[model samples]
Target chain A: EPEVTQTPSHQVTQMGQEVILRCVPISNHLYFYWYRQILGQKVEFLVSFYNNEISEKSEIFDDQFSVERPDGSNFTLKIRSTKLEDSAMYFCASGTTNTGELFFGEGSRLTVL
Target chain B: TQLLEQSPQFLSIQEGENLTVYCNSSSVFSSLQWYRQEPGEGPVLLVTVVTGGEVKKLKRLTFQFGDARKDSSLHITAAQPGDTGLYLCAGAGTNFGNEKLTFGTGTRLTIIP
Candidate 1:
């Protein structure tokens, strides 16, 4: 079965550095999403994208965060300036229908030093 | 804000045992979904319940949505090693379905072999 795939399974970057997390969602999926889970915490929604634009975002998704579908297959989350609090497991997911049965990739562990 | 709280933050069971994880909240939801996440991996969707008092089954797993749509539960029968993982429940406004997913803190289950 087609699944979401994320690259750089682990990322380590210093504070104030820029980092990009990449994901290639299942082909033909119409909606894309980014979520992060702090160690021992709930998975929090970062943002959602559809129709090539952001549909919604959470407060955790602030100025430092941005998402783009640079090409037809790649969806990326960019952190302009990383912070200690930004260290978390970032997951990308996609769903073909509005029913919200999302398929998630094995997350990319981002460690902000 | 919608919040789904999963009970028994951690649970350990012997093989062939039955267990149930509960997800509850004070707010109503349009639909509820259950997901399982393994270490270092993103959550994999298990089942989604849409209507009040709805029930869904996947293999030895059973999922139910509360009558008020404010809670859900996942029950595993004769669980195996493969059933061990972090279980999460997400709720969202029905009308805005597929727009966003609000998640719970998650319940980590360990089925001892």
Candidate 2:
């Protein structure tokens, strides 16, 4: 079965440095999303994208966070400046439609020093 | 914001035992989905329940959505060591244009041999 794929499985960056997490969603999927989980916390929604635009975002997705579909297959999340609290497992997910079942990537573990 | 509360944050049971994990919320949802995540991996979708009081079975695992659409349960029968993982439940609302999922805190199950 086709699945979502993410790059840089693990990343270590200095605080205040820029970080970009990349994802290639299922080819036919139309809706894409980003979510994060702190070491021992629940998965939290960050943002959703469709038609190459952000549909919704949570408070955690502040000015420092941005998402882009620079190409047909790549969806990237960039943190302009990393903070200690930004360390977490970031997941990329996609669905055929707004209400369809979501498929997730393995996730990128971000560690900010 | 809608919140999903999962019961019994951690469960350890012997092989061949049965267990049930629950997801509850005050807000009603249009659909509920169950996912399983192993260590170092992203969540994999197990099942999706759309209608109230719907029941779906996947081999030894069974999922049920409450009649009010505000709760759901996952029951595993004759669970084996392979069944051990983190189980998360997520809800999606019909009115949300982006259809973002609200995930529960998750239940960590350990099936001991």
Candidate 3:
């Protein structure tokens, strides 16, 4: 079975530094998403991307967060200035359509000090 | 904003016990998905329920979508130690082509052998 893949299984960085998480979605999938889960908290949606642009974002997805599908295969999430609260497990997910079935990659754990 | 609330935040039972976890929401969804996440890993999709009052079974697990499309449930029969994990329920909005999933608070289950 094809699955989504993510880079940097774990990342630790100081507050106010830039961080980037990369994901390679399942081939032939058309929709992509970024979601985060704080320790002991529920998973929260950050943004969704389709057609090489963000289709929708949640209130938590502020100006500091940006997502790009730089190449056809790689989708990236960048945080310009990390905050202590940004520490969480970030998951990358992909789906072939709006049908709501998505495959997620093993998350990239980010710890900002 | 859509919200999914799951019941019995944590459960621990003997390996042969049968258990049920629920996911409920005030807002109707186009689809609802159940996922299982182990420590240090992203959520793995277990099943998706789309039509109202639909039921799907995957081996020892069974899933049901409420008639109103605002609630769903998962029942596991004769659970094994391997069934331990955090279970999350996600709901997709009725908006067409918008694939963002709003996740539930989650239910953590541990089956003791």
| DockQ values per model | 0.73, 0.64, 0.73
Candidate 2 CA-lDDT value = 0.94
DockQ of 2: 0.64
- Report the C-alpha lDDT of model 2 over B40-102, residue by residue, as the tens digit: 788899999988999999999999999999999999999999998999999998744358899
Candidate 1 lDDT over A4-90, as tens digits, reads: 999889999999999999999999899999999999888999999998999899999999999999888899999999999999999
Instruction: Between candidates 1 and 3, name the one with more favorable DockQ.
Output: 1
**Colliding residue pairs in candidate 2:** none
What C-alpha lDDT values do all the predictions have? 0.90, 0.94, 0.93
- Candidate 2: TM-score of chain A is 0.98
- Mark the regions of model 2 whose C-alpha exceeds 4 Å error after superposition: none
True-vs-predicted CA distance for residue B75, candidate 2, Å:
0.7
lDDT of 3 by residue, B1-113 (tens): 78899999999999999999999999999999999999889999999999999999999999999999999999999999999999999998876446789899999999999
List model 3 lDDT by residue over A48-102, tens digit each: 9999999999898999999999879999999999999999999999997656788
Among residues 3 or more apart in sequence or in different chains, the pairs in candidate 3 whose N, CA or C atoms overlap within 3 Å are: none
Clash counts per candidate, in order, are 0, 0, 0
- Candidate 1 ranges with C-alpha deviation above 4 Å: none
lDDT score, residue A96, model 2? 75
Local accuracy of candidate 1 as per-residue lDDT tens digits, B1-113:
88889998899999999999999999998888898888888888888898899999899999999999999999999999988889999887655546688899899999999
Q: How many Å off is the CA of B39 in candidate 2?
A: 1.3
Residue A7, model 1: lDDT of: 88
